[model samples]
Target: MDRQEKRAFVAFLAEVFASTSIVIVTENKGLTVADVTELRRRIRATGSTYKVAKNRLVSRALEGTQFDGIAPLLKGPTALSWGADPAAMAKVLVEFAKTNENLVVLGGALGSQTLDASGVKALAELPSLDELRAKLVGMLNTPATRIAGAVQAPAGQLARVFGAYSKSEAA
Candidate 1:
């Protein structure tokens, strides 16, 4: 590519490295367009972006960034999966990798924290952002639900009793 294109990509990658909560680097060698399109669609569905970029530009982008730890892994047919929600992206990549044999995950970076293969695996296994939010909402709603049930119990019993009395009077 031209120098201007490279510079623009570097700038873009630098911004991504800065803003993203997590970045997963992969070697997507020999992956077909169909596979890539599927992966792209999945990433876009989750408000994420997947890019196959040149190593030089990626290396330049990693300069002085928090995710500089991942710079070295940019070699080969490197594709980056990045988004605002790191957990979601990781989960999606891991799940996608289960079926797509061509995509090999090298490692990743979660902010300043560097993740090895095992770290990435662990992250993949953890509940996603949406799952965590759902769990939290369930936890918060539980007490309210219980309280409503408790409050309605006596009224329900009283209504049942009155209904039975009226039925007996008719008998």
Candidate 2:
């Protein structure tokens, strides 16, 4: 690669490391072009990215970043999957790997903490930010709904009682 190309790649890697919440490393040795394209599609659907860069460049880019510890995992035929939501990226990688044996998850770095393959899988099981937010909103709404029903109960009972009393008088 030309010097200009190298510089551009380093800059791109730096941007990715800066913007992402987690960086997942994988060894994509024998994955076909179609398989990679499919994986990229799935990752893009979740607003993340899948990239394969030189290990040296990755290590250089990782230096001084929160994902510095992941440099060790960059030694082999590494591909990186990363995004704002760690769970989403992990989920995609794990789900894709389930069907594609060529994609082997090595390890990853979340902030300063490095994680093994199992750790990445565990992360995949966690709810995403949007799911967690939806749960929170549901919890918040439940009490309000119950409160409204409780507040209306007395009036409803009063109306029912008046209706019954009127029917009895007519009888």
Candidate 3:
């Protein structure tokens, strides 16, 4: 690549490292083009993306970024899976690594905090932001649903009682 292209790519990587909540570094060595394509598809489905950059370029991108701590993990056929959702990339990489032996999980960064392989696994275990929000909404709605159900029950029973009494009188 030319100098201008390199500068643009470095800037783009820096932007990615800055804006994203989480980025998982991994080695995609010997992974077939089809496998990488599949991984990208899966990542996009979750509103995330996978990128492979040269180690030197990624290291340069990390300078002055919160992801500088992750520079060590940027070696050897490194590809990054990143997204707005902090949990998504770690979750996807950890799961993919489980099935694909060639895709080695390197440490990553969630903002300034550097995560080891085990930490990445732990991150995968945490509920995603969306999942937590859904859970909170469900929790908040439960009481209202129960209140509606309870309020309707007495009226339903009263109607049933009146219907039974009327039928008996007619009989």
Among residues 3 or more apart in sequence or in different chains, the pairs in candidate 2 whose N, CA or C atoms overlap within 3 Å are none
lDDT of 2 by residue, 1-171 (tens): 998999899988998888777889999999999999999999998888899989998888888899998887887688998888889889999999999999999989898789999999999999988899999999999999999999999999999999999999999
lDDT of 1 by residue, 66-85 (tens): 98999878778989889877
- Sorted by TM-score (best first), the order is 2, 3, 1
Ranking by lDDT: 2, 1, 3
Give me candidate 2's TM-score against the actual structure: 0.96
Model 1: residues with Cα > 4 Å off, grouped in runs: 166-171
Instruction: Indicate which candidate wins on lDDT.
Output: 2
By TM-score, the best candidate is 2
- As for TM-score, the candidate ahead, 2 or 3, is 2
Better of 1 and 3 by lDDT: 1
The C-alpha stretches of model 2 lying farther than 4 A from their native spots are none
